[model samples]
Target: MKRAGTHRSDSERIDLTVRDYGLDGGIASAHTVRKRRIRRQTRFLAGLAILLVLTAGGIWLIKSLSGNTAPTTESSQPTTRPSATTAATVTPHPTSTPVPTPVPTTTKPQLSAEERQSLLQQAGDEVVHYLDQVTTGRIGIYFQNLVNGESWAHNDKMPFVAASSIKLGINTYLYSRVAAGEISLDEVLRYDNRAYPTGDYEAGTGTVQNLPNGTELSVRETSKLAITISDNCATNMIIRRLGGIDAINPWLNKISGIVDYRQKVSYTNYAGQSQNGRHRTCARDLGLQAVRLFSLWQENPQVYAPLIEDLSHTEFDFGIKQGLPEDLVVAHKIGTNGAYATENDLGIVFAEEPFVLCVLTEMASAERARKIQTDIAAIFYEKVASWPWP
Candidate 1:
């Protein structure tokens, strides 16, 4: 029985050993399967890492290439306007251009003789028409061609009071006296108290100054005063000094280019009378006086040069000067009275071709007459100066 028992133990031991071995085999197989799976998984992870590296490298290369091709894309994209400017360098753009301005010219057409004459006649008729509107009495007007030595007068036959414009006639006579050496221009004379019977202190009447009862002035100065200011006292003095009334007759008759004469009244008798406003001449005669003065100024610029120069410095602009351009220099005489019927202006306008014009009017108001004369003179200036008259 012991032997049998021992053998059984050995068998049992053998079985146990087999069982242990089987268990070991089983654990070993599991370890082998697990190691194989781990190795496969490690291999797969390595391959995936390589693929990912390759993909990242490719993306970086592509970006670098794109950045090189388009310079602004790597940084921020450039603005649209800047992009347009850059594109313009590669491709030309269509653009609008600017235009320039034009200049002015000065050439004008020349007028013909018939055209000028017709213009003058039309201008004269217009002047006459204008004058008729301002005067109820008579509107006497005259014009002279100083260049051609011709004259025209409407109502030339009638005589109006010289008023103050006779100063021009007095000026001519005074100049004649000076030219003849009858009275020296530099000769001084005492003021006679009887000369200024109409009160000596009238404004714009020149230097007819009563001389404080004993003041003295030169004949030239007196003549200047007579003309420039129309001083009645100075005029009286000059008339007395000029060989009186009959003396001026020959001088008046001697006016050859145009002649309109009325009987000469002596200065002494004329002034002495209570009914005397008698110093008289018409528009034609006054225009003649202007022509004569202009001719005198032209012929012998030295003879009456100072007087003409002085006359050009007219301060009384109410009559003819009112209508003329301020730039024009006019040598003129004006006449006015308290009575409205006689207001006149006679003047030589020194313009393109110097002209002689006379505007005489008889109306109810002296102011109205002066305005009429001014309007007429303006018309003459407008016509003669190559300006439109109407």
Candidate 2:
């Protein structure tokens, strides 16, 4: 009999007659064929199971390499399965990249030399035209635009009586001494009969003269009186303290554009005259002095602030200060000599665009000179108000 659960080829079936002859004419059984077909089916099912296992392993390897997790299925379980609760609660994160912030930029406009000169000339002509119509005095004016550094002048070389304006130079000398540590503001000086003689007592602009003869005032207080009130007695006291005109003139000469600065004022007179001669200054020099003082105010406010403060409180403002808006600040000095028929004002206008302006007049009455000064100042203010300030 043929073996059970065994398969045979077609050739073998064809040769079954020979085999049957050898087997003494035996025939194959149906039970043996059925058993052989069942065995083949079992082998095929095992091969399909192995193929599914290999495919699953390959998918898991690909997911791990790509930094991802393979999905779990209900029908198949991996070596380790995430808890159903953990997998269900997972939330996806956004992958958007961060952006950078932007920076701000600024733009500044520049002026040309030609344009600056043109503006300066136009302003100069306007000032000259207005001043010519107002007074018959010999006027000297110097103007400087603090912003653009443009300058204009009329009769700048001419010299006129310094009058009380010499107090500016006096105040500057005192401050210079203080800055050099040669003197102290707190140091006191006596207002005695020797310094202010009762016989030669000047009745001009200060209260210090009326005080008791031996009353003591600090260098600080004396300087304030000289500038704020245009006090002749206080000025003479400070001049005497500084060793008279000989000592102060050299300091004034060091300033640029200053041609003539001489004479010490007598207590009996507001005019800056002595045995030496009358003190003289020009518009150009006064304007430059104002510029220097402004620079000092900017560079060393603690040391120079009091001088500017006293100037701001100047009680005589019938000139430049009269023309400006009441809200504006002007650090200036005014000089008037009724005997000489001279009136002048020199100062820095602290406006939207700050500037230095000096107006000096000679051979004119006080009333006419002041009117001319006011008109000239008003014209400058108008021009500056129109300019585009930075």
lDDT of 2 by residue, 249-338 (tens): 877777753556764322212233332345777788878888777766666667787888788778887898788877677788999877
In model 2, which range of ten residues has the least summed lDDT?
96-105
Q: What tens digits encode model 1's per-residue C-alpha lDDT throughout 40-89? A: 99999999999999999999999999988985534575565666657777
lDDT of 2 at 367: 82
Worst 10 contiguous positions by lDDT, candidate 1: 96-105
In model 2, where do residues sit more than 4 Å from their true spots?
1-110, 195-203, 263-277
- For residue 259, give model 1's deviation from the true position in Å: 9.9
- What are the lDDT scores of the predictions, listed in order? 0.66, 0.74
Clashing pairs in 2: none
Quote the positional error of residue 271 for candidate 1 in Å: 25
TM-scores of the candidates are 0.62, 0.66
lDDT of 2 at 390: 43
